[model samples]
Target chain A: MFEYIVSKYNYWVYIFLMMLGLYGMIGKKNLVKKLIGMNIFQVAIILFYISIGSKVGASIPILTAEDLHGSANPLHYMNPLPHVLMLTAIVVGIATTGVALGIIIMVYNRYKTLAEDEILEIRKKSGV
Target chain B: MKVFALLTVIITGVMLVYGAEDFPKWGDPNQPGSVHVAPRYTQGTYIEAGTPNIVTSVVADYRGYDTMGETTVIFTAGMACILMLRKKKRGEGESNV
Candidate 1:
């Protein structure tokens, strides 16, 4: 059990972070807190992918001069796919956060509150 | 409601832990993620693109189309934000809600 835990501890840490973000998204009543949780969740996922691409003694995904001339060993460098995918993911996360913040601002302007429950209550009272 | 949320989080955590049991050890070179296409990229990046940085070459060369689409998505998102949040001039179809 200890060996298994030690071997896969990175996954466990990311899972724990994901759960924390999930809890914040689900339990928090404030709209901004929910956004923060969503950002955290995205970051955790990105970290998980980056961790998967790592190798024990590998350098970054840059080819050294020696590697370029000789047969490059895959094990000598980290996987590039996950890093590429995560770059896209990071951009999408930023775009999502920007749009969500914009919507939240619009909500605040109209309803004058950032709490989910209060916004719902205002909607109920207004019959909208 | 908070209790329900906590329960959901715990259940999700448990499920994730269970699923992660079969994952390869950290920094294991032979992990599935490092096999297949990754090896090709690692070995052939310099030959194919003359770029030393495999990640950069993949993103900007091999996957150029994907990055272009990603840029389009971001542009669309920025336009949506501007459309949704920009201030309106008075008496320009403004109404009290």
Candidate 2:
């Protein structure tokens, strides 16, 4: 039933995006596409963590007098863990992207093509 | 061989992500991870480390060595890429010369 399918929507969406990234990584023939897949895969982890931290009926975690002194409302407390972790992950992702792009540019300069098969052929002919 | 590879992916994916029920509920006091004995190093993180978060404490303190290892891995990969992509000398370029 749709209810059953939607019961755990956050995790399901995360898994779906992760699988999509995996498929793109494996099925693509071009280096750029592979890099895109790698990005997607990394972002998918960020999404997974964010989803796990999410709570129904939760509000953002900025403190106000209504929240602190008044009777605490459990329904509106946001999880602060993933917000912290996602910032770290985004920095790491950017560093990896820079490295990957650098390698790709170098690869293209040497081989003059982005396709893995073409690069391999050129390497074979040139004894590289 | 292809079928085996597919099976492995499917099995592992299912095992690791079994949906909301299997994971420890948020703020669940009885969860194994919550009940597990925390290391002594994690205790000081709440105050002296100036980080209220415990997981960050675990990452930058107790498991600080692991972050260093990840940096090393990245450094090694960068070095390997440079080595692989380096241009050959004129003599090397002219292999049949």
Candidate 3:
């Protein structure tokens, strides 16, 4: 049981971080706070994936001649797939954040307030 | 309203934690992820793309198409931001200029 918990510590930390982000996203009233939560959530997810690519006794994925000479061992290097995919995910996340902030700006310009309740009230009144 | 949001968050967190039980332990060499197509990329990087960094080879060589799309997404996002936020001043109109 101790071994299991120790080995899985990274995942547990990620899960906790994910919960924190989720809470921020859902429980917060401010729109900008929700965006911060979203960024936290993205970073946590990226960290989780990068951790998955780790190996107990491995170097980076750049191959040496020994890696080719002796048996071509996969264990000699950390997994590279997750790193590659997460790079794209990070770029996408930045794009999404930029767009979301832009939308928030437009929303604030029209509604004159960033509070969720006030915006809803204005929307209901203005039939928007 | 806050109470409802908090309740939903707690429920989701519980479900996520429960689901995490089945995931492979950290840094386990034999995990399916490490054994799968990862080996091909690691083993074949030099010959396939002449790149020492496997992440670079796989991202820019094997998956160049996806990267192009991602670049387009960011560009579109920038254009959208400008289009949404920019206001034309009365004196700056094409006819006036």
Candidate 4:
């Protein structure tokens, strides 16, 4: 069990980070805090995917001169698919954060508050 | 409410950890992910895409359409932010609506 846990400790660390982000998103009242939590969650996921592509003794996903002429050995390089997929994911995450912040700004402008509970109270009072 | 949030987080974490147990050990070359198309891409990237950097070729050449879509998504996001936050011009129609 110790060896099993030790071998996969990276997953454990990422899970912990994800849980922390989840807690921040769920427990915080402020909109910006939730946004921050969401960003953290995204970063954790990206890191997890990047880690999935790693090899014990592999170089980066670039071919050397010998590798270029001969058939490139997959084991000699880290997996590149995860890194490529995560590149798109990172772009999407940035877009999400940008739009979310814009919406939060609009919400604050109309409600005059950033707290979720206070905004709810104002909405109830105003019948909106 | 915070207690409820913590409980939810703990439950989610436990489930994820349980699922993660099935994942291959770190840096195992024979793992399912590495055994599949990764080898093909690694072998053919130079001949097919003429790029020594496999990642750059995969993103820009192999998955060009996906990258294009990603660019569109970012453009949409920028437009949304501008539309949402831009101030009204002076003497424009009623600002309340």
DockQ agreement of candidate 4 with the native complex:
0.74
Residue range A33-126, candidate 1, lDDT tens digits: 9999999999999999999999999988889889885389988888989999999999989998999999899888888999999999999999
Clashing residue pairs found in predicted model 1: none
Candidate 1 Cα outliers beyond 4 Å, as residue runs: B93-97
- Model 2, B1-97: lDDT tens digits are 3355455556646765764457654443343432233322233444445454545655676567767866776676677656655676766654321
Scored by lDDT, the top model is 1
Q: Is candidate 1 or candidate 3 better by DockQ?
A: 1
Q: In terms of docking quality, how is candidate 4 classified?
A: medium
Pairs with steric clashes in candidate 3: none
Rank ordering of all candidates by DockQ, starting from the highest: 1, 4, 3, 2
CA lDDT, every model vs. true structure: 0.91, 0.62, 0.85, 0.89
**Per-residue lDDT tens digits of candidate 4, residues A58-121?**
9999999888854888889999999999989988998999999889887877778899999899
Arrange candidates, best lDDT first.
1, 4, 3, 2
Task: State which candidate has the highest DockQ.
Answer: 1
TM-score of chain A in every predicted structure: 0.97, 0.88, 0.89, 0.95
User: What lDDT would candidate 1 get against the real structure?
Assistant: 0.91
Q: What TM value does chain B of candidate 3 have?
A: 0.87
Ranking by TM-score: 1, 4, 3, 2
